[model samples]
Target: MSRTSRTRLRLVGALTGALLAVVAADPAAQAHCDDPPTLADLAQRHGRYFGSATDNPELTDTAYTKILGSEFDMITPGNGMKWYATEPQQGVFDWTAGDAIVDLARAHHQKVRAHTLVWHSQLPGWLTGKEWTADALRAVLKKHIQTEVRHYRGKVYSWDVVNEAFNEDGTYRETVFYKTLGPGYIADALRWAHQADPKAKLYLNDYNIEAVGPKSDAYYGLAKELKAQGVPLDGVGLQAHLALQYGYPTTLEDNLRRFARLGLDTALTEVDVRMLLPATEEKLAQQADWYRDMTEACLAVRRCVGITIWDHNVG
Candidate 1:
């Protein structure tokens, strides 16, 4: 599933034309890529960083590595830092996968956006295997969040403190954390992450929140509340995982603006314009249009810090 669920390349415009530019501000800073100016170069001009989500296995492929190293300036470990990968046992922890990707990013002169700290999916059996009282669960949660964030401190740019907390209808998802710790767990997670790494930005990342809708509304309300309480919430990640069949989020720009209004950074994280199989040229053109529109929307907003393509697939 990890390999097949690949987020294939969706370039800025036509795949053939410019392929996007990446010249340094001084043109004397030295070129990272031999020719094409990467999306990272283009985004840097606007004080932003473009990046992608990569896995440990793919680093060996030179073809993919070329783009992974040059096309973007940020790297997201798609699953490396998740609960399962980070903590396979009740008290034990692992950093092999997470460290590999972060090392790759640093080698390429890129910043790291740690994929997530608290999430409902891909949890290790030791965590999801048993039931727990509220207090016990809270302790476990805090320990896990602080442990991981602390380990990656000063290395990562941000952490997806809590991911996909709200559902499509603006209601909370009934995950283990929500079931045991309640909605306040989200706030607690953010605060704990901040304590672990005061310099790192903390974000709530989710898909399908790119537009003005119930899901985004839930985030906006929660972000406002967190700020009023002086919680350490710093950003909102709109995962912008759009499909051609569902149509683009027409209110995307306004949605970004609203988050920025609340004094929080916004990013088009996990961007991928997907379509059904046997895609025609016409469909690909429209797909490119979707990519272009999303890119322009992020660039138009000041607080929309950067964009991260989910990663490219050549297989």
Candidate 2:
């Protein structure tokens, strides 16, 4: 069998038990793709990184850990590296959870894609409890970004410096950062993170921006503006959280191409195709096709880095 056919068969096997049973019926199928090429392997062949988000709790499960270690070339902590977990109290940092994952990735010879230095959600209670002057909030934001980035400097491959900053209609989300620090906070946060870790790639990540529309247009405009201003921005991350019910973003490849044209690396970060309740065989088949299509899309673009599943198992 051809490598491409084997890849398709393994992808089917990984997604559906029924498909796996069918493949098992043929000894040649098992021998050809016995140890299927992991997403990481296929991505690496195209000079990209393939990864997934994992929580610390799942790390304790041996089966889960084994799959994570062997099957991926990169890893992102789902929540351990967030502001609430890392710096629950102001000026005091706890590296326990994030460190554990980083160490695991190291043991597995995998790169770490540190998530979310600055985000509207998962912030510490101390930060959200009070109203503050622009100056005070700016200082707080700067400290958080710098401290977090510096702690993980040289260890992580990239950082989602800012996440979900814009809304569906290309308007800025009125988070505390925007409300207090103004729209320039995005640029400010990116600069601060770069200052802390000059080597790590910085990204602005968001969802609903997979197609060439308002939300994506906002990012394209902002990315160009930032680059012109000599901002230390490196990439844009698309949280391709698709649902079979909602359908796939057909213009996803074109959208990624536009970002690459801006001299920015693009990635399908936090990807998952979820469907309602009990999944049918047809839904599973559709889901598998979506996964294959996304991988092919990334491979087609030179600057497209890789795809990271939101979690290990797709439900």
Candidate 3:
């Protein structure tokens, strides 16, 4: 067999092992999975980290806290680090909520993946309610990226510098930044983020790119272009927010491998397998299989660094 075939077989075997391990898990240790290898343990065995998205309000629940601390070694703030949450008013910043989550991560010896320096959604009224020239908006965006990224500079493991910047058809979404600054906004956001936190890995995150299609192709082209220009683009985050009805992205592992070939680290940034109402046991088992498959895919790739479930409590 060729080297490629051997690697493929190894990946398949790893996936099968993961599934069997899940199937054999003791029911009594289901909450924390004390008997089976936790996701973090499995990831660590492959020199990767496992993480989950979380919010401040959920931090107050003891049960939630215990599971989060025990099951994962990294945390992504679901909202507290977004543009609106970090900078509620222009020229003013608030780190209260984001800091709280960071504190929690530190206490648990978990690294934080500070999410989202620039996104079209969750914009504060101060910036969105007004109109401005391209130059003015550029300044605002730079300051926001610099301030937020600098604040969490050393504390974060990575930053989703630009989130969902592309449409499903492989076109750039005409968000305020894109309209004002053109596609250059992506490169600029990445540069500013690197300036602020030189050590933190920067990523462009999006959904529906788990498969080899137009959307994933767009990211591939952009990543190559960014690398050519010496941009500090470090990774691509595939938000695998899948649904059972849609079936699995069969090309997920291949997609990740292609991105890794660009000398970029790949991660499942936000993963959840949702189903229609009244989810049956069959659906639940399917979801579990997907979880195992995703984990296996990440472990299979050398440049695939980690996996982060969207949030802890999603069904």
Candidate 4:
């Protein structure tokens, strides 16, 4: 292989290691950084990036924008690209929200992780208002996925093609697409997305899959099946929305390694160490430790590409 290819492979193996804790001890939400070596700065040294999710509304606030643009290299559109916002009315597309955030990211020289092409929630009324035959639903689903993917084709770095497809128990979610189109909808969604934008990395994004459990096992089985069939799937998004009450899932590293063995990149996609309202110092310290542990696990895996924090605010 050429030198360029070798370097590229090295980066691919070197772990972009998305540290969602881009919100850190330096106070991620704080307007100005009094300290040198920002999280993005450090991550850049290792061919990695830390990211935060920002909505269209948050762009105008100078304080938020200051931290957002300067701290994180990868920006995730929190609600702009979801089904309800992008295509509120059937065939009547609105790019106002999604485009604004993307434009902001571009001005700052940051890449975009376009969220959620297909998901159960946040769908428009046209889609969930009434029932339809399998063929009609499939057509609608395809048009939505392809149109949105094509519009953002060259702009985005990755697309969360299918989001939250399984329940906590590893059962297929009986979503509109699933109930009508059945389990094959996921493979079809990934395939259609690849056709629209072959270069964009496709991912199956979900929560409660940060560890080796029923939900993640469901994804593992599906990923194996898709890879075997030569479907265009690139990675899995583990929304590591950890809670202080439930305790951290200690099996996360092993879980990431298993996905790496599948030849797929993994990410702590929508991470936040949530806790009860009475934020105690003890709990806060534990949260910080949890974030650190999670980052170390992803860094340990070669195929772990990136992480995006669910919320950008710091305590």
Per-residue accuracy of model 1 over 123-240 as CA lDDT, tens digit each = 9998888999999999999999999999999999999999999999999999999999889999999989999999999999998899898999999999999999999988999988
Which stretches in model 3 have alpha-carbon errors above 4 Å? 1-37
Pick by TM-score: 1 or 4, better one? 1
- Strongest candidate by lDDT: 1
| lDDT score at residue 300, model 2, on the 0-100 scale | 72
After TM-score superposition, the amount by which residue 150's alpha carbon in candidate 2 deviates from its true location, in angstroms, is 0.9
lDDT of 4 by residue, 1-315 (tens): 001100111121122223423424335433443455555665654456678777777677887788788877898898899999989998889989999988999999999999989998888989899998999989988999999999998999999999999999999999998999999999999999999999999999988898899999999999999999999999999988778899899999999999999999998877777777687878766776777788778777878876666646421
Question: Model 4 lDDT vs. the true structure?
Answer: 0.81
**TM-scores for every predicted model:** 0.92, 0.89, 0.89, 0.88
The residue-by-residue lDDT of candidate 3 on 1-315, one tens digit each, is 001100111123344466345434646434544566655665666678888788898888888788789878899898899988989988899999999999999999999888888899989999889887999999999999998998898998999999999999999998999988899999999999999989999999998999999999999999999999999999999988888899899999999999988899999888777778696778767777777788878767889898877766521
Which pairs in model 4 have colliding backbones? 18-307
Ranking by lDDT: 1, 3, 2, 4
Clashing residue pairs found in predicted model 1: 21-37, 22-37
Error of 2 at 261 (Å): 0.4
C-alpha RMSD of each candidate structure in angstroms: 3.2, 6.7, 7.8, 8.9
Clashes per prediction?
A: 2, 0, 0, 1
